[model samples]
Every structure is written in structure tokens, then in C-alpha cells.
Target: MVKKKIQVLFEDEHYIAATKPSDLLVHPFKARSQDRRSLLRSLKKQTDLYLFPIHRLDKPVSGVVLFAKSKEATRLMKEQWNSENVSKHYIAMVKGVTETEGVYDFPIKTDKGLQEAKTSFKTLTSNDEYSLVDIEIFTGRQHQIRKHFSRRMHNLVGDTKYGHSSINNIFRKDYKFYRIFLHSYQLRFIHPFTKEEVIISSPVTEDCIHIANDLFQFDLTNIGNEAKEN
Candidate 1:
């Protein structure tokens, strides 16, 4: 088991949000895998409380993950998330330079079938090789960000699943980085229990910052600051 200190971003009676490291499962598979590392189990042990996940992040993706303290709070928070009351923001470094800003209404295929997914992106900074983009997602469809960007030829750096192998190889040899460059930087919504607006922002990992600086001379320290507004 890989032991890592769980970085809790926000904690209250009804909710807890934490920063999930890259390559860590949000929860274990039903059948379970050989690797026993999981974010939920670690949080349960660290906080010594039952926690319910309100949203999920991909195993290779890093950033904010929200949980409810109890089953009732989970139900309420899930309702708020299902509605239009929540905003999710992410930052990514893609293979190609992107437009200044754009919205993608591409539908992602799910177990149910093709579902409508919308993503809005603003190119924070870019060079000839890659673009650092700030993303706002309106839907929670499976692999929404990855699929949408990959379809448009702007595959995320280090995304072996959706990116070009040659491109990824070039980056690996050049930058010597492995994790995918997609991060859930911020989540904002109305508190289901207290009715107060809640905003949870996760800072990009040190690796992410280092790679961005090397690639685009970018600074991710305040990447989510402008997107904090509701």
C-alpha cells in the first residue's frame, strides 16, 4: 500500500473536500486489484469517519474531490451536483496550441449511450508546441475533457490513453514527465446543508507546475483564482 498524507482542502460537519494525487484510485474496484492504494480508504482511516464520494476524478488525473460526511449529506450534495448549481474547473496542457477560447458541446459515449457534454476552454498561455488551458465543464459525462480535446487534435500531454504515441514519446524523452496534464482545479456550489456557497480549489501538483514552467514558461500558482467567481 502506498502511504500518502491525505490533503484535506475543506472540512465541515456535512462535507469534506480533498486533493487527490495523480494515479490514485478514488475507490477500489468491486473485484479489487493488487494495488490497495485508494483515496477513500485512506481518508476514512485518517479522519476516522464514514465518507461518501459526491464526484469522481479519473485515476490518472489529479485535483479536488468532494465527499459528504454522511449518507444524508451525500444525497443532498448529489442532488445539488446533478442540478446546475455546481461549477467544475480544470487546467490542462495540451499537445497543440489552441484558440484563445472556445466551447465544445461534444457528446461522450457512456454505458447508457451518447450523452451530451459541454466544455468551455480558455487558453491561459501557449507556444508553438503546447497550450495551457483553463477549462470549465458543464456536464459530468465519462472522460468528457479527454474525449472532447482528443477529438479536436488537442490531446492532453502524457495521456497515453487518448493521445498520440509519438507525441507522448517526444514529450517523455524531452520533459521526462509521466502523469497526464489534466487537473480538476476548482469546484463551487451551494452548500446543501447550510445553504451557503462553497468553493474548493486544489493547487496543481509540484510536477504539474514544473512541467508547465519548462514547456510554456507558465506559472500555475494562481491558475484558478480568476475562475473562483460563481
Candidate 2:
């Protein structure tokens, strides 16, 4: 198979931020024995440098992912992440309309047990059938956004794990949309080396825009720019 190009959004002496395509793993896993192609490995081949993953996106979710260039940079970035100093923002197209703004302050179950997870969301636009939401995650528990939104009965579009199978099938058949409708739109943090504030963002994929327009008549032309500013 031909390799998909990893889209680099930002790069510097200490860090790199890149857009990860859906269905791609951030790192190789023993559990996923057959799936060895990962973003880290691909980046290593491309840059020919050892890279450290600072954060991860779900295999089926596409968007910005951060990596550190060195062990020290990784340590510093991980410290910021653990302290909740890193700001993560995402855009999700969901099954139903939501309030103008709301927060899902709930605990999610993990292998270690239940952990506190908080996600805030603002409705950007909506029709009767679907809503485009801007989400800010306060906690990084696994599948936090997907689980929280599923609890609210607004499972993300094309999310088979937490969403309606029929809806996913419909999109797949009609629009050829197969990936979850969640994009890691923005990441903001203080640079570990420069000690300066940095913000990085990724544009919504063209497929997502086409699906939104075709299915809901929603325009996402300025969403990326607006998301970066806010």
C-alpha cells in the first residue's frame, strides 16, 4: 500500500505538531498485532530522527497530534500535559442539536477504574438533524469526549463505537464517510524550550466539509480560521 503523507502543522527545534489521519495509530501496540504502521514510525522515516509522542488521538479520529524532538522536551511537555496546562480543542459533528453551550462533568471508566473527565462544548451551528460543536477538554481520560457525548445522546457522526450503526451505515453508503466526525482542531501551550506561548491548529478535512454541506447544509468555510483565533 502507498503511504499516506503525514501533514505537519508546526515544527521547531524542540517540538513538532502534525495532522494524523483517521484509522492511523499514534504508536504501535501489542494489542493491535496486525496494525504496525503508526504515525511515530512514519514520522521517523520521514524526518530520520527519534521522536517522542506527547499526546495521542484515537485511531479513528483525525486531527492534530504533538511530539517532542528530544527526551528533555518530552519530559517538559508531559509535565505541562499532566498539569492540564495544554489546551485541547476539537470540532465534532454530532447526531443531534445541542444547547448553545454545556459542560459534561462526569467520570469515565478506564482499566484503572473510573476517573474524572470534564468536557465543555459550544454549539457552532445546527439544523434539526445535526449540530457542529466546538469542544474543550479539561481532562484527557481515554475516549473522554466520545463517552461524554454519548452519555448526552449526541454521539458523534460516523462513530460506530458510541453512535448508531444505522446512521454510520447511511453515511458510508451515501457519502463514503467512514471515519468518526471529530477533528483535533487546536492545541495551545507554552513552548518547553522557548518559554513562549504557541498555538497550533489543523483545518477540517475536505471530506468532512463535503459531508456537512451535503447532509446538513452547514457551511464550514471559515470554521478553521475562526477556531484558530478562538
Candidate 3:
């Protein structure tokens, strides 16, 4: 396996959090014997220790992701996650204007077949061609946010598979970007073993900022409707 860079966000005796780069799989694949790079293997090799995944971010989604260093920590983390004790937040640039805050409660099915689920969203920023959306998922389904928005009138900027042709054509169709516009910015949950509240966050990725700047000439200001417009 060839070596690659790993971005560690927060690390401790019990667990580790990382800003996962786009297009990297959390774990290795049995389907492909030739693909040698995987996040799990990279961390283990670098730390000489095992880590457990408490939750998964999609291959295209980039930013803060958590991993447990010990079995007990892993178990407890998973418990907190399953109990709806965690608050996960993501920001994305989707096509079209979202005038007010809204929720998307639609059923999402699996790609292999049909075991669909539901999710919701709230718009934080509005622009003529794009909006900065703050998203939340009630149910953990594969590509829930991506697929849901893709099926809508507007599509997330860099999404290829579920995105509409006209919207996606504004960007590249064949290439999977270095990162998608979606970013896992905030995570809040009770400490798995400590029984205390913990909140972790990552600043919105630069790629999104650049895209917004190129199109809207925006900084963080216009994300809120009340905030000054760019």
C-alpha cells in the first residue's frame, strides 16, 4: 500500500478525531485488492494503535470525523451516537435561492436497492444562484443529504451522481473534485465515558469559501440572512 497524508484533528487516550479529506474511504475494500490506501490502515500504521469508527462520513463529504482508540471507548461512543445524543452539522453550497429556513423530510433509499429513510435541512444563507445550507440528518442513511438535494430543483455544487445535468455542468462532470462543497463543521455529543457534554467543530473548508467567492464574492458574513451581504 502506498503511504498518504492523514489530517488528525483531536486525539487523546480514548479516541481521535480527524478532518477526513474528500474521496477517501474510511475503511479498506474487499472488492478491490489493488487499492492500497485506506484511512483505517493509515492511522494504525502512523500511531501503531487500533482505532474504531463510531460514525461514517461519505466519501465525498469532507471534515471532522471521529474514531475511538480503545474498545470501551468505541462501544460507549457508538452508544451515544445511536441514542440520538449527538448533533452533527454540515454546510453546503446548493444551487438556487432558499428564501427562508426550511426542512427536507424525504425518504432516502439505498443505492443497491430500496431501504429508504428520511432527513431534514435548514437554510442559513441565501443567494440567487446558490445558498449555504445547514443540514441535519434524523436517520443515518447512505448519501441521504446528497441524494435528497440532488432530486430537488437545485443540486449541491460538486455532486455528480445525484445532481442535475444543468446544475452540475456548471462544474466538471467527469472529475470528482478534491473535495465537495459539503463540510462537517460541527459535532456535539456527551462524552462516551466521561458523561460530560463535548462539542467539536471545524471551520468551513476553503474550497467552499473559494467557490462562494468566485460566484457570490462572499465571506462568512452572508451566511446569515441578517448578516451583511457581500
On TM-score, the stronger of 1 and 3 is 1
TM-score of 1: 0.93
Clashing pairs in 2: none
Candidate 2: segments with Cα more than 4 A from true spot: 82-84, 225-230
Q: lDDT of each model, Cα atoms only?
A: 0.86, 0.85, 0.70
Error of 3 at 67 (Å): 0.7
Q: RMSD per prediction, one decimal?
A: 2.3, 2.1, 5.3
Q: What does candidate 1's lDDT look like per residue over 109-165, in tens digits?
A: 877799999999999999988999999998888788999999999998888889888
Q: Which stretch of 10 consecutive residues in model 3 shows the poorest summed lDDT?
A: 221-230
Question: After superposition, which runs of candidate 1 have C-alpha atoms over 4 Å from their true positions?
Answer: 30-32, 224-230
TM-score per candidate, chains pooled = 0.93, 0.93, 0.81
lDDT of 3 at 24: 76
Model 2 lDDT tens row, 42-97: 98898888999988898889888999999999998887784566789898989888
Can you write out model 3's per-residue Cα lDDT over 132-179, one digit (the tens) per residue?
A: 778866666678778778777657777777665666665554332444
Off by over 4 Å in 3: 1-5, 111-118, 173-178, 220-230
